[model samples]
Target: ATAEKFRSISPAEFFYRNKEIAGFANPARALYQAVRELVENALDATDAHGILPNIEVSIERDSVKQYVYRISVKDNGIGIPEKYIPEAFGKVLFSSKYVLRQTRGLFGLGAKMVILYGQMTVGEPAEIISAAINSRRIYSYRIMIDVRENKPIIVSKGVWPNNTGWHGTMVKVAIEGDWSRAKQKILDYIKRTAIVTPYANIVFKTPDGEIYTYLRVTETIPPPPRETKPHPHGVDLELIKTMISETKAQRLIDFISEEFQGVGNVIAERFLTKYGFDPSKDPKTLSKEELELLVKALKEFNEFRKPRADHLSPIGAELIKIGLNSILKPEFVDAVTRKPVVYEGHSIIVEVGIAYGGSIQPSEEVVLLRYANKIPLLYDEKSDVAWKVVSENIDWSYYGIVFPAPLAILVHICGTKIPYKGVGKESIAEVPVIEKEIEEGVRQVARSLKLYLARKQKEEEMMRKAVT
Candidate 1:
């Protein structure tokens, strides 16, 4: 056999060559994905700082090049600090969203990939303008990615006067893409985003010079999620090792109580005693054998309370009703917010909404809108776990619903850790606990729709009798 040839590559180089992993498989999809990644980042930044999102997105054709467009997104959000701006936008796998909280952008590869794609096609660096919240001045930088080194190369830097007293970020990139093919998906994605996040104000200026604005329907923003300690049930050997390395507590007992949720002084001491580990010993000194034993004991222990669900920020039922009414204009609308459920030690909450009759278009199949952690899932609908639960588990016939029925089903799952089936984050895996919660939540709203339909049929029957 010939000698194998192999070489190591930086994260940037790897993704530069395999752009499909970041959802830039084709020109059309790449354009859509780039816009989505930036918009989602802007929304996340605004949400993190408790600011009502005022995001502006524009797509304009390149002056001299066909099928090339300049995409710009500006948001009134917490801007990136000046020092970290280049790395944040140019380096791959660098992100600030690693905390244990609900977030739209899971991996740090989104915005950087957009810049890299642009560099590969158009040889243009991304322009970034940012003014941190409460800062005195705004800073701008033109930067590009050095794929070989996985680093940012700043081309230019400047400062601007903050005359308007604004705080946010603006990013501009020129990329080779097919706007004609991506226009519809881009518009639909924006519309769906508006429905789900009625509190955000978004404007889109297409390449055709047409501008669309989505006004905020409510001033009330959902409560932001809070970070929480990992639950004891969720901890594995790797996590335990990480905790030991980073923990401030010197004693094993203190470490247990501080690092893991639902573990208090009493429980910690008891656990240590049961596992034959010394409570007063240094947890960092645990041998490999001892660590394995501790992990096994913890997995077997069933006395700990379930993980806290407060880390999850789910959209409530009333807001769901308002959103559906505003967007779908359905005559009858109902929603349900399920109680928190645990899946593999992760806390998850499911919210479902049903809209029937009155302006909602009838179709041969049910219209489904799926969301995870407030981010809309636009593709791979059929394979999603939420779709599976809605199609296979729910009986639409019993509720007087049939093909071409005027109905819309909305399902949103919020959690600290979403079990995504793929890197695209477009679908949820079929975890039994998650599927059951979705089915139950949908059923609750479906019952309300059924009653409304039954009453309407009765009224129609009476009207026909009176006419006779």
Candidate 2:
């Protein structure tokens, strides 16, 4: 047992030591993160299934410990199966979000991180009650994560008779938190989420005995995103090698067509022939050099169609407008949903909404509401690609957005894979394609704002003339 140590740390253990990576840097952020993780998880579950979301969140201050609070979130969504209840909520990276589809969770460690944080701070297991869709019986369990082992240790289990015939999931945990510091962020997160998710009816009860309820403003819910095959352009040498090994097709031509989207038999054969590759050759038999050469050729060949955006589900323009007007009661509002485009093989769609005047408070600088995959990113605004486009690229006066005004711009970027600057998921990388799309989206709504401002000025001038 010398100072030097060698070990294989599991994913859960890595998170245990590096809790800050999940935005639990302090008591304040940890508390906000707990609420965020739970709320986002609820949104993912319900939205994926096209179920209108009914979410409830409560944080109560513990009398025994001023800084410790009981945090709970209950949602009407598809519940986890009985067997997966423990690991799904206790393990760090054991969930269904790691695929070629859109979901609110940035990483597989959703509610599990909350459970781990609670376990470390309050030494309490998370209490979970769940009933899967179409199931009759309800299951209840108290589970804790063994961070070192990277698994769940179930403390207790029971069954609740389903006499009422309702189904969903409820999670409760007691954790140390700085409520005074985290309250504003938590409230803003909820409000922003409501603005984007207009179909969800959310009721939030604060520790201060205040209740903020956001009622559902629209019945429209975007269709569920479809799981898609990877595109050829989205891969590199290692991915090609892995695909070659896993592919059932023995021939290189068949393998290419079968494994990758937008690649067909004719295109695969043409690519193979152009690269001087044997179409009949087994891809698995290719050496490292051959594979590298093949990947180089794949990139060079330009006939492959762009990746289909079927896997991306974006909140439509109408829904975004409804959500913004309902929440902000803005005097003017306009929203635009951009068609999806490929970026690094992932589908990226940008939606921008602008709300002006009315109930919105005037600000010295432009208020930016940024979202990635339906999750509100309240921190690190300057680092996000959207902010860069708005702050640096656009001329605000041209769009009639001379600030010290009640103006807020909302940017929502939906992608199969988001280029986040950090693991915190607070900021997006300034990828060229993302920047272009964001700029275009903002301009689309900004023009509408300019028109509204022009009309308002005309009306004000007319009123002045009549008064004189």
Off by over 4 Å in 1: 1-3, 466-468
Summarize candidate 1's per-residue lDDT along 261-286 as a digit string, tens digits: 88889999999998899999999999
TM-score of 1: 0.97
RMSD of each: 1.4, 1.7
**What is candidate 1's CA lDDT for residue 206?**
96
lDDT, candidate 2, at 389: 87
What lDDT score belongs to each candidate, Candidate 1 first? 0.89, 0.89
Against the hidden reference, what TM-scores do the models get? Answer: 0.97, 0.96
Q: Enumerate clash totals for all models, in the order shown.
A: 0, 0
Whole-structure CA lDDT of model 1: 0.89
